[model samples]
Target: MTFLNRQIHFTAAPKRKVLVGFILFLFLSFVIIFVEPFDTDQYHSDHKILVLSGFGILIFFVFVIYSSFENLWYLKFRKVWLVSHEIASTILFFVVAGSVLYLYNGLMINQGSYSITSHLLYLKNIVLLMIPVFAPVMLYLRQQFGERIVPLPINSVLLTGENKNEVLSLEKGNLLFIKAFENYVEIHFLDEQDQVVSRTFRQTLSNVYQQIPFLEKCHRSYLVNMTTAKEIIGNSQSAKISFIHGEKTIPLSKTYYKQIKNRLVQK
Candidate 1:
């Protein structure tokens, strides 16, 4: 269960999906032509190529549809793709594509005279053949083209305000602290020249905090980047935070003193 829940790289690239479909079509056609699987050898030589092409086409369409749906589900929910998702989708592809191909064989080639037992047997054979080809190709494509989910580094953060075009992009290491005043918050950070600078954005502290959760909340109105903090001064009852780059000190509320102290100790 734990292994299935592990996140994996995934891709919804249209070109890659189409390439996969094309590869499967070619592979299936080649196998059917050379191996003469099932009732292929019994078909008339004149119509054999056309009939075999239809089987490949069916597989291609099914693969495209399956991949498109998977891509759509990912876009809609924005969920991380996991091992379980990959496994389930693979099983679904085998069942759906295998069943369709079996029915196609029966109707087009066998004159629709296949029994239930024969259908199951055909499906089983199709699945067995597909497993060796499909699984490795998908794994290779995913490794080559799939996108991994990764968090934005602290050095590259874009702070946006409620007003249009109000934004600040800076390294979190240079950020000192944020001070809240009702609907506005002041972001203090060091400039490239090592000077303390402040920017006022028309956004509440809560909203800003949501954007950068790594910032530690020391008081009701302040969110400090602990990376810039030099040390905690004064006692627990009246604690204050001193920064390495600025003369100003942030007040530490009793509500968050212990938690902040523990975090600072860990740092």
Candidate 2:
């Protein structure tokens, strides 16, 4: 995939993000409780419970926030690093924010930055409302990274004819039907609502099949995205493969029938 200008894909999930955020929030909360910030006033103890409770409340939305950024960055610029940076930056921001809260209550409050009651109220608002501001910052970081230049492949090969070696990449998806760009193929994605997202890769189908052993010659002219294929139908002259990536049917040739059919069916 590195040889071609194919987009790097990571199967990062929102649910995984929720777990990560919940873990971070919980860990921060634990540190705050055990190493409760140094305070001169007894009233400061209640603030710990308030801050932790606030984290718990905000965690549900934390999951939503991180996942939205991942999906958006994946579609917009097709870079995994953007999503990772967004996640890391957001988590680090919260860590700093939590530490600042500790400093405010532990030392600054005694130094008269704000009265004890006012600080407690500020803590409550911070817990509930800070995400709106931080989310944008994280998003901006992702956008900035997206603006960085990654050159697209300069040379391309046609996979079906004399230039068959020129195809740099080809992907098959259940949601995407065959798209012919002169001689290039692009696998498209369709969501539950039937929205399409084109995932273009530069590479010849033959070279990819040779390089990625998991791929097979599903047809004379069609190479099934092995990852997206579910089943195969027909035999020899009229063979076709069924793709799970989308419900599209692809034709097959006699030369590829039994081998490709067996490979797909066994899976």
Q: Using lDDT as the measure, which candidate wins? A: 1
- Where does model 1 exceed 4 Å of error? 76-79, 113-116, 151-267
Tens-place lDDT per residue, model 2, 1-267, is 333433323325555556555654565455445544333224354565765445433544554464556566554543334444545545654554544554554464445554556655555655335556446643543343333434334321113233424333333233333343444555455554655455445545564455444445555455555556767666577767766644567777777777776776676
Number of clashes in model 1? 0
Least lDDT summed over 10 consecutive residues: which range in candidate 2? 155-164
RMSD of each: 8.4, 15.9
Model 1, residue 142: displacement in angstroms?
A: 3.9
lDDT per residue (tens digit) for residues 210-255 in model 1: 8888898999999999888888899878999999997989899999
Per-prediction TM-score, please?
0.54, 0.32
